[model samples]
Target chain A: MTHHTASAEELEALARHARWLVLSTVADAGAGHIGGPLSQMDLLLALYFNHLRIDPSDPHRDDRDRFVLSKGHTAIGLYTVLALRGYFDPAELATFDHGDSRLQGHPDMRMLPGIDASTGSLGQGLSVAVGMALGARLQQRDFHTWVLLGDGEIEEGMVWEAAYAASRYGLDNVTAIVDRNGLQQYGWPAGASDRFDRRDPWAGKDVGAIFRGFGWDVIDIDGHDHAEIDRALETACGARGSAGRPTVILAETVKGKGVSFTEGTYRWHNGIATADQLAAARAELGQPETVGVAR
Target chain B: MIAQRQVWGETLVELGASDDRIVVVDGDLANSTKADLFAAAHPERFVEVGIAEQNMVGIAFGLSTLGYRPWLSTFGVFLTHRALDPIRMLVSQTGAAVRIAGAYSGLLNGRSGKTHQDVADLAIMRTMPGMTVLAPADEHEMRAAVRWAADHDGPLYLRIARDAVAPVFDIDTTWEDWAPRMLRDGGDITVVSTGVQTSRCVDAVRLLADRGIDARHIHVPMLKPLDEDRLAGLLGERVVTVEEHTMIGGLGGLVAEIVAARRSTQTVTRLGLADGWSESGPDAFLLDKYGLSASRIADRIVGVHSRPVGTPGV
Candidate 1:
């Protein structure tokens, strides 16, 4: 699980591709989830390009590590990574949200390649990942299953059900990362609730402690910090083999991290970028007129 | 005579041995539903979720997520009524492959009263997206359906009767594959029946033949994705649909959609339970009162065909 460094040129190019992919897809369709996709773009780029053991051309490679984007509304990041990894032609990204397109609003395993599970209804993906991990263990395959979850999605009761089951089974091969960006659809997690309240809802909840209480090896890290992310993943790999204990990484992230206007705003979670907004965002991301190797 | 309810439990136990991934879940009625065999053999896999049918469904969804093929058994009344939403969201929306066995269905809960006898399970499950409905004709077909479901990866809802009706199918016959089978043949009228009600329809056909009435009976085990083409071919100009389930969303409703679209000169007579809760009594008494007996069915067919040579009677 050592971090294999992608050249600076490759990193920049992948980041650029992921950023433009989400922006262009949103622009092509009349709407899309903006903030979550923008925030998770770097994590997806790093995984697909540098770490994930997968062959884009051979999407169904048996030994490939499986990845599920449980928070499927932010599919732009994952889809772009799949395209760059060669799962499909990059040109198909433009057709996102169009009629009869494989790249729909959410990930569909039947339609798209390299997607382990088709997910949109939150709190179910983690359970499926646990299944995949169990399948691997039963067959003695060395592949791991990773699931990306959104912070707001934790509100679903089924998430806790899966968490409890995963710990009970001691599914070490499965790892879950919650993009701990406080805002949800309506407003902040606290503002959107009457039943529950918290200051920094993500931190105050003690998601790590809950996992530990359920017998999981918990790791908390800054999602944007690549070095820390790499270290946590490596530790998770080592922890996976030691007896029975799964790992849950609580990744603290900023919604719309790079963009100034949309950053940390609940309204921007599913912001429809105006023509002006699109142009400004594209300029800030350093997207060129013609797409090439993303120099 | 073997009940459809018993076959479901027996087949699940047999399949569980071969397929270790298969798990049986019961909502505190393992003995009633006959899933105790599975519980004894595969203790690790068998989960008794108490009497919480709603929570049982949610847990089944959770198990299906972990690569376990969970077959949940419960009374039709509770399984369909109490857990409809979770089953719809988890199995239909997320595309989990969970099998739900609804026993004691459609007036089969003898002496269990209105609250226990379920005539709505078929209507409820038939309306779900990505849900495959299997209403086996007899114990043989019911066992086969359970075995087939274990190998198949998708959501399934099966309705079973509690009464020990005589078997309509041969013990050697393989109807468990979900493929519709042709039971009897004739050119005059086609009779499509499902579940335990199919045996009564067969008996009705025998009675009709005594009075020189010719009819074809096509037994459909799979309800959803209703064999539209197979049904169209068999149902000529005169057809009758029968079920122990309510006529609204049962086999009658399914056949009506296909027949209406084709605009075939065929007239369909639907024989099923009338829409109402029933009083507590033996299932035999309930069947007689509801006009679900073979004698009543034969009389109805005789009355319809006697109308006119070319036209069908309403």
Candidate 2:
């Protein structure tokens, strides 16, 4: 099946629309994460709209490329992207996090289409992605596997364990995108104690160097820039399965992007958005003031 | 007596010959777990994932999604204790068809001490949703269980012992309906057992017969999805459970729960280790120390049998 590759300009517009959907989805649920979803909005938009070779109608096709959201707390972002990409009806976004809803608090592959794996527990999706890459090689298929991880999620040792295995197996068909958003759920607040002086846990640590040390081809880029995201995805796909090395793209971003009050703040990492906050966010994204839920 | 792990390795190699989807993912204990035989036969499909058990399970889950039957071979403790989160999330929650062959199960791996031994694998694996837990009685049953798991479509956990023991069932014995098999039929008392300890229970039953105490022997291979109706029919007035695992949640706990749910007046005497760790020693010494030897098991049954009716045995 042929796929339409959206241009950089189109992807930018989609990202803006996705940001509004994410904030409104969380607002409708009264319980969801916002900061991480906004942080990884452009990255997911660029991949779903331009790179991933997937058919929304045939989500489980054998040869389709696989994508796993490692940082599954931000599933609202992925659900919005999947709905916009036509994997399911966009009106179903209102039922997210509700009882009997297919859109669970975390991604459940069994309950929803287009979810390659059920992932909520951090530090495990990369390993599953590595296995998918190996399966592609064993089955002699050309499909690629991509996994998105959070910066704080990297603190899990299992992530590094999967990193070593992907490198050891020479799985070039798999690519890892780390959302280096520089904020976790619990960051240092203003003027509490000297011990809590830093904003994030990895304030001064070099994430790209760490992935490079794990024998991956590291590509650093601005996560919110559609052009940079498009370029990094191109490079990652170009080196697929032939370079004999897995590639990791470290995309630097804010905790919450595209919103003046929420950007770069951990307070919005996971919380209910009041009507006032939702209206402000929608107004900033150039969306209509009707913010009960996204259509 | 042939080692169960050896039978597992040989059976895996045979399965790989006919099914190209059979892949072995070992966690650096291929030789100890006897997965090396499959590696030697199908080197291309063998994945040496080093000593990472969690990642090994995650990889198997990934492969299972793409129609590949991946078997994860590792020590039982690491599989149950260290990699439980991955198994719960990646395999059980999703119902992935990943085979987890847990080697060196039970207290029989005495040389490795309590740290390496796994005495509660059944308690853990059986409780997980959508997991098929099995513990074969001997080499013959191990072969059958391995072949069954190869064709079954779901998450499965096979508990393999470290040492070889006597076979309780014949080579042609097949698991029918995933039920508990009756090795001996008697009327005085019923003795239920699972895993490698069932063989000892068989010998203990013989000894009980010699002592004029007729004891029925029921061997359970499949712990989860147990044939509860069949097992309830086989239970007698007095029941005793024996296993190499802990006393709390192994065969003993299972039998006790079944008996309690029925509200039957029959007494259940649980025989296994207490709520603590055992020292490193030979299999015989450890089994004897834990009241699991054939003679010791026979003695314990005799004590429970001699008790008056409606009186529980501690």
In every candidate, what fraction of the native interface contacts is reproduced? Answer: 0.05, 0.80
lDDT of 2 by residue, B1-314 (tens): 88999999999999999998899999999999999999999998999999899999989988989998899998989999999999999999999999989899989874888999898998899889999999899999999999888889999999998799999878986766678988889999999999999999989999999999988899899989887778988999999999989888878888888888988777898898888998889888988988899999999889888889778855
TM-score against truth, every candidate: 0.80, 0.97
Off by over 4 Å in 2: A2-4, A187-198, A290-295
lDDT of each: 0.76, 0.89
Candidate 2's TM-score reads 0.97
True lDDT of residue B110, candidate 2: 42
lDDT of 2 by residue, A1-295 (tens): 5454788778777877888888888877888999899999999988888889999999999888899999999999999999999999888999999889999999999999999999999999999999999989988899999999998899999999999999998989999999988778885653432122236656656777888898999999999888888889989988985799999999988878998877877788988777788778878888766533743
Q: How well is candidate 2 docked (DockQ)?
A: 0.86
Tens-place lDDT per residue, model 1, B1-314, is 77777777777777877787887777779888888878887787776656666556656765575578888878878878876766766677666888888888887686888888778787888889888988887887777777777777889888888877778877866653455667899877778888888889999999998999888888888888666787688776787888887878788888887888987777887888777767788766877888788988888778777766556423
Query: What lDDT does candidate 2 reach at residue A111?
Result: 98
Error of 2 at B192 (Å): 0.1
Error of 2 at A200 (Å): 2.2
